[model samples]
Target: MNPFNKSTGRVVLGGAGWSRQIVTDPTSKPVLQTILHALSLGIRAFDTSPYYDPSEILLGAAFSDPALTSKYPRSDLLLLTKCGRITANDFDYSPAAIRASVRRSLDRFSTTYLDVVFTHDVEFVSREEALGAVKTLFEMRDEGYIKHVGISGYPPAVLADIAVEIRQKLGKPVDVVQTYCHMNIQNTTLQRSLGRFYGDAGVGIVLNASPICMGLLRKGGVPIGELGDFHPAPRGLREAAAKAADWVEGQGENMASLALRYAVGTFASVDEKGLGVTILGGGSIEEITENVETVKKMLKMEDNSVEALDLRDYSLFDEEAYKKDEPLFKGVRDILGEWIDYTWDSPDAAFLEEREKRKNQEK
Candidate 1:
């Protein structure tokens, strides 16, 4: 299940943030340059999806570039793409559809085999459909079309449970599992549940995305990013995020810098070599550079120092639940208490809500 060797570091370059830009921009030259720059910074893994507009095509063109291909061959890079969820309200998990999706991704990515392929946002579909798509992906892996198979979604519990379900049914474990918004400073759900994933489901690698929690943990903090239109968080949580930013600023530290370092430090290998992987999205060259520099600072910090331990352990959450101390961290945690483990309603929830509305109208 663990395809990567000990030498492979964990920083993955994500293509979602650049999804819009790549599609609207007339030239691929800028994005290509950013990709090349990221590669130079030791980011070997790239994560993209068909749902993210033209991300797959942009990455495909970047890799297909003669200059880039010559510098970093396709074999050296780990290319990961997702399927199933098409739009906010659209998702298709049938085996036939999945097979076709893989074909399209393969064609678009210009690769015969994908290093990893995840069933996107499994939380939105029926459990049967999600597992069915995963089983199909397993078949694809067996057929030599995919090197690894897994699922991606919002709920950490659901992802871990499905991984266990796959093992029970198939007699084998998922090669990798990715869950976002769980490992960041605001939420520590992943740390508590990772043991189940590693021991019960036998997941090889645990991939954490949206380290900044999709811009919720950014400099501006609350009122999150404009991307909230697609997956809007609760109003209370947004206000708490804003408060946390103010608190962080009052402490003479930048919210984003602290957040980035905390995440990278927590997941990163303590030794010189990076042990764990974290997928980071950057729209520009400066953003990518800043992320790399943050890790460098984390790497150089003395292991026993208070700052290092604080960043690594974070102490925001315990095994049982998230802690309510450290003033700033506690203040934000308290505001999010009601929705601590809460995720926004999925498409399935929306369907049920609509059904209820119709029944009420009939009555």
Candidate 2:
């Protein structure tokens, strides 16, 4: 069966927003409101990870609420979740561990089957471990536990390589892939590497998250508390982003909204036929409203005077349309020229140090 044949919507409601008190707090009205509102906005997919605290349970409860059950039942939504890389310092790719993780996720989400299950953040682990996780997920797929199986990671090159490796070892293509921060305005690695993932590696659908690149592209900057000390990007990139945000505001547009528009707009407008989904995290009802509005504008622009070109407009394989329409953003790209496509290390040095400590203890 074609993996993309199902009703996987173009936009997915991200569960990262519910990671902390939003999900942990049982009476969080905002969480329920956001999910209901998202369903109203035509978002039929939800992406969550076990590592994201109680997100899975929170989403499950929200979907099963009596007020929403009949109007938007579990059957109405496409459930997507991930396993492996449990925390910054914890990662388990063993077959038995992965199998157990999936079962626990099923319980947490209160679902019989998952629409998709991804091996989260495969770059930090060894190839053998990563492939083992994918193999087990594929096994789960065959067992009728998951409809589609795939992997997600930060590095496009690493994700592409692993997708190809999985196809070679398992004799089937990866059904989906989730990569964040790569398709945003500052970094377009996902766009540049689309051909490799779609053609060479055989990824059926691609999901892009963090249109604002984890708040680095927010006005001022990402608060140190929100992302902690290991926030990845260099100080220079952060500073440049702040300046760009101010520059964008001077042009009378919200920086975060503009970034969202560019990322969501380009992907939704492009008629490539290859399925793509943008995962957006919403904290409150207003945030969900803003996201839905951004998507509406994205769709409207195609019929309006924007004359936005289709994905075909980009030469043979490139998907970075921001560079092509650099003139529209009023030199924001020029201001960030020094940091374009610049990526800091993921599973940062601190994470790596803890990884070694864990290994030593295990040994």
lDDT of 1 by residue, 34-134 (tens): 88888777677889988876777877788878889888877888889999988766789999989999999898777899999999988777779988999
lDDT of 2: 0.74
Error of 1 at 311 (Å): 18
- Give each model a TM-score: 0.82, 0.87
Off by over 4 Å in 1: 21-29, 221-228, 268-275, 300-348, 351-363
Q: Scored by CA lDDT, what does every candidate get?
A: 0.72, 0.74
Model 2: weakest 10-residue lDDT segment is 310-319
| Candidate number of the best lDDT | 2
> C-alpha displacement of 233 in model 1, angstroms?
1.5
Question: Which numbered prediction scores highest in TM-score against the true structure?
Answer: 2
Clashes of 2: 0
Backbone clashes in each candidate structure, one number apiece? 1, 0
- lDDT string for model 2 (1-363, tens) is 234433444667788777652333433546677777777666778889887766777776776677777786677678888999676678899999899989988887677899889898989899999988998998898898999897998988878888988888888898888898987778877776677778877778878888788777778676343335545788899889988998888877788888886777566544254444678867667887787666545543223434533221112212354444446554777889989889877767887888789889999
Alpha-carbon RMSD of each model: 6.3, 4.9
